[model samples]
Target: METVRTRPGAGRQGGSGRRLTRRQAVGALVAEAGGSPLRRTMGVGQLTLLSVGATLGTGIFVVLGQAVPQAGPAIVVSFVLAGVTALFSALSYAELAGMIPGSGSSYSYAYATMGELIAWVCGWCLILEYGVSVAAVAVGWGQYVNELLRLTVGVTLPDALSAPPGAGGTLNVPAALIVVLAMAVLLRGAKESAVANTVMVTVKIAALVMFCAVAFTAFRAGNFQPLFPLGTAGMSAGAASLFFSYIGFDAASTAGEEARNPQRDLPRAIILSLVLVTALYVLVAVAALGAMPWRQFAGTEATLSEVLVRSVGGGNLWPVLLSVGAVVATTSVVLTVQYGQIRILFAMSRDGLVPPLFSKVHPTTGVPRANTVIVSAFIAVLAALVPLGSLADATSIGTLFAFMLVNLAVVLLRHRNPDAPRSFRVPFSPVTPVLGMGFCVYMLFSLGADTWIAFAAWMAAGLAVYGLYGIRHSKLDHGAGPQEGA
Candidate 1:
């Protein structure tokens, strides 16, 4: 085990006052863990399912209803465009994941290739990406749960307990409840959480498959008329909204430290998950558009349920069955995204970039229990009080910002260290990274004006935190040598 200054007992400023160069940060990351390493137990299949489970939820079930109105039947085109944009960035992430094999995701890559300050900012962006996303998914899960109850038991959650304050409700109790439940699951440990994730993933996939199967029975060629009714501008807008669906495919890379075979498996999991998710998304989009007029999909909360009722006859049992599936799908999304956020906190804390409490792994469970508790508490409050639309937009911008940094890292590393061993290299190097960066920038600007303003404010807060604490107290700032120089 690497003996480094990671505990609360270690002095804050005990080492020589010097910042870590990018090269030194990379060396320290690859050479040492701040304490005993995280357990290596996950194989490629488990890692791939984690990515799929995280990526598949919320966006498909919740955002599709909102997006369909933006592009009419051409929402199918929007899905394709967004998937392509995510693919470029996913490729860059795969290359970095194979080479770095660390837990910090894009933040760790930026630290190794850019510098500590930039990495701190990237880590902060992930806080918004993963943290806000969990809250957003939990809110969506609450909506589905209410819908399921209404469908199956002829009851609805009272508005006071169903919606956030911003949405005209006192508190979203169901949303908050699911977040706490997911936190409890994670506290049990990684393997246990992974097992839960796999089961939920199967349930979600079966749900989507059922939707496609029934929707196809009602396929009407006339439903696709005026394919581009809203024009290129609307299609582009829908693509931007739909991009949030792809957010968690990179969750696979966050498991690098725990993967039993990171070098070969990480890249495979990243690519495989993206491919599977994109295919599933396309199928779902086509089936929905084929089943009904796209204009009818706008602003509906229980979109898939409505479609199922209309297609299979409302008095039957299929709609209720599908509503149950929607509940499971959104819950799985909350579980997986919450899991990713804690691991990122674990990585950042181990490097002394955040509070050491975040790195406090449980002795028996081998999980970052303290980190999960802290993150879950904050997210639960957000889910209870915040509106879903704002949370979703904020998460999209944060993710796009991180994607830009990851692409830049791949470009910088290629030029700086051509000889570095990489298990997976991004094909067509400079072109791919440049295109990835360009796509991310385009989508970043495509977001709503309010989202940009909120993102700027979030960045300002992160910079303030970094200047006050992260910069001064970083283990890297203290020149902690590889292996602690003992």
Candidate 2:
């Protein structure tokens, strides 16, 4: 409907640029051919499930195994600490989602207040958060699938081929396959994806509850002795790790432009999902720690399913069932991540923040087919080639950095447009935003050196692309002048 220019387009550099109304942001983005895949009922409850599907994956099943060993039994405290930080940022996001009410997520928020450059950086961060996370989740899924195969089919794959290069494995076929599979499912469009996502979410939660119920019998208070024997250093590290588990809190904002009533529903979805996810995380952490020794959680080949087996006297069909649930859980998260990527790219493309190709919609599926394939292929390669630990850390850094931007954007928007019809506002105003910023920065710094290097390189690559193309063809330069002026 519009074109973006390098220097300054219609609105700024003497051209007639159009500024969309609040209603238009949500409805217009969905008006491609037949409509956007994101425009669906997805009320608060479904949106909460979306967050759960995304948040409850590797963080609990695989990553927790590593975090538990790092922090000992105090991992419970780590989960809570990380949840607090997420809550702070979620509150800020709710406010912004109410005001902006669009799908760009951090990208749209940044563009609204921080100008063009920062928005591109946020969009780049989202690429890492969504794009890389899909691959990472797939890698975890491949592990679950291999475990399920051995349990059900009575056959085992060689570890040399099962793991990634980081883990001394050659090529992760299962990981790549699942990524492709998720892509196929997503190609069917959002409604179908949401239905599948909901079912997977139910299975994952039920599986978690089953673990808690059965594993309870093996609980021993002594298992938690010297809870902080590793001291503050270990617990802090665990907290940092636990922080990644809460990464999906902001996923709700990416749907802002598509919500049935974004101003109202977006805020509700963002906050409600955060609360549900955090509580679920705390309960899961409590159950796992109470049932086993702190040191045993280094995570076996099967991870969470292994906990059920080793700690819960699991040998019968229960372990198999739990493994199935984990496989479904990880798969659902990958789907959700991919869906978010499409919508974000749609926003950026429409705004000319990136290549317009990302915004192209498939006539059949009403989905971003080309962009989805491109992102999926890239993730498959990453999953097949990279190390899980490094991927996990990189995903965490990307997410934390985005949280920082969302929090700051909330405060700046409130100040810049106090009269805007914000359906929700953060409870503490300046304090909440500042607190959110501090928490994200702390967690961002806690990442390992390797993660820092990968993050820096990923960002540099994004900058190069933006400079080469996006800067010259951006919509912000032309449209969206002072609120009153347009």
Candidate 3:
């Protein structure tokens, strides 16, 4: 093998780990740019926009309907809990993004600190958080699109082609369409895609603020009575569901190489983006949940915006705008989600842990064409074929696992490579990561049995893929690898 093994915790046990040097990371970025596609397609501004684009999507709109009855008015604390948990992981991610500063985010970190096996597992968990996360968003998007159609044009989509296979429907057609559209945009290159996403982000922000301002005007205190009506059980359930809304914040890390100065920008983007999204979510939840009784909100996906029009007298104008906002947000999320997936594959491909085809950037677009297609198809199938709640819960479980790994990694990296350059460090070191880990673990078990079962199945499938393909193909296996100390 090489001077140092390329496994999780491998860095701790020995000599220099065979991690990719910063130069190698930068070189691969250049090679994948059609050998130079978009010379400078991103900056601090674009990076921040991408962060916002990735994060401010479907969760806020649909999740409120699901969460309101569960936590009552205390759903606010649940959101805060979820956001705090995310901040812990974000702090961990900040350190890794600065130190590794490469594509694949946590996967790359696991590779450098742990090894290929851990990296594969981390990548697999991403399916729940990143890949399936998008599919979940697409399902939410389906709900909104149909809502808009019925409200404005009086054209209701049939349930058969509108939901996943598990939801007693034939297909989720809108979800698949959005995935396809995202793939097309990704194939065009990052700069143009970022531009489109910027517009979508703006729309999403406007819709969120408008929703809060409008609902706040018609607020009533009586709706707060019997808060936590279902007891702590309900509040816990709401917190678990709200986890879905924060999925996109990690997308900031995937731009490790593309950032103007990753050391500085990545940390800023991660923390800043989380703060921004959390603040918006709190405002919207307070306004929407406060305006109506929680018992009336259950079992309906269009509860928030519908309540807005009913309470505020906006009629069709406001609800339509909210629907449009959700659609735009979901579309942009698909784009950024696919982008992160491709770049992670690209990183793995370059390291020879995956088929070389995934590393090949399109001649024209400079994007990883094959990987993008595969991820896009994966999302489309789930969107078109399945309408399962268990899948969404499983997604949260997966994301929490991935975040736990990243959090633990922060501690591991510090002790292993104390000399390594870090643009940001998590405060209180082990305590923060430990708390982060505990928080995620709690959420992981909080998922229902069916969701846990689904998560296990995904993990099993990923193991098979890695065992059959990754270890054998890994560049580190044959002693062909990056610099030892960099």
Query: What are the per-model numbers of colliding residue pairs?
Result: 0, 5, 12
Local distance difference test, per candidate?
A: 0.82, 0.75, 0.75
Task: State the lDDT of candidate 3 residue by residue for 1-486, as single tens digits.
Answer: 123324533333333233222112322222342232323457766777788888888778778777887788888878987788788888888888777777778877776666567777887787567777788778777777898899888998888889766677888899898889888888887777778888888888998888888898889877777666778877777877787678778887887766657777888888888888889888888888777767767777645688797678867888788889888888888888778877777777777777998877777766778888998998889778966567666877777788888888888777766765677889999999989898888877776889878888888988788778776666655445442333
Query: Which has the better lDDT: candidate 1, or candidate 3?
Result: 1
For model 1, residues 1-486, the per-residue Cα lDDT tens digits are 233543442333444222433323455666553234577888999999999988988567666688988888888889899899899999999999988888899988988777676788889999999999889878878887887788778899999998988898999999999999999998887888889989999998998898899889999888888889999889988888888778888998888888888889999999999999989998988888888778778767536767767665757377677767778888888888898898898888877778899988788888887889999999999899988575567888888889999999999889776777899999998999899999999887777898888888889998898777776667655555432321
Worst ten-residue run, lDDT, model 3? 20-29
Q: Distance from true position, residue 482, model 3, in Å?
A: 3.5
Name the top TM-score candidate: 1
Would you list the clashing residue pairs of candidate 1?
none
Segments of candidate 3 deviating more than 4 angstroms: 1-40, 164-171, 221-237, 298-302, 387-389, 483-486
Give the least accurate 10-residue stretch of model 1, judged by summed lDDT. Answer: 15-24
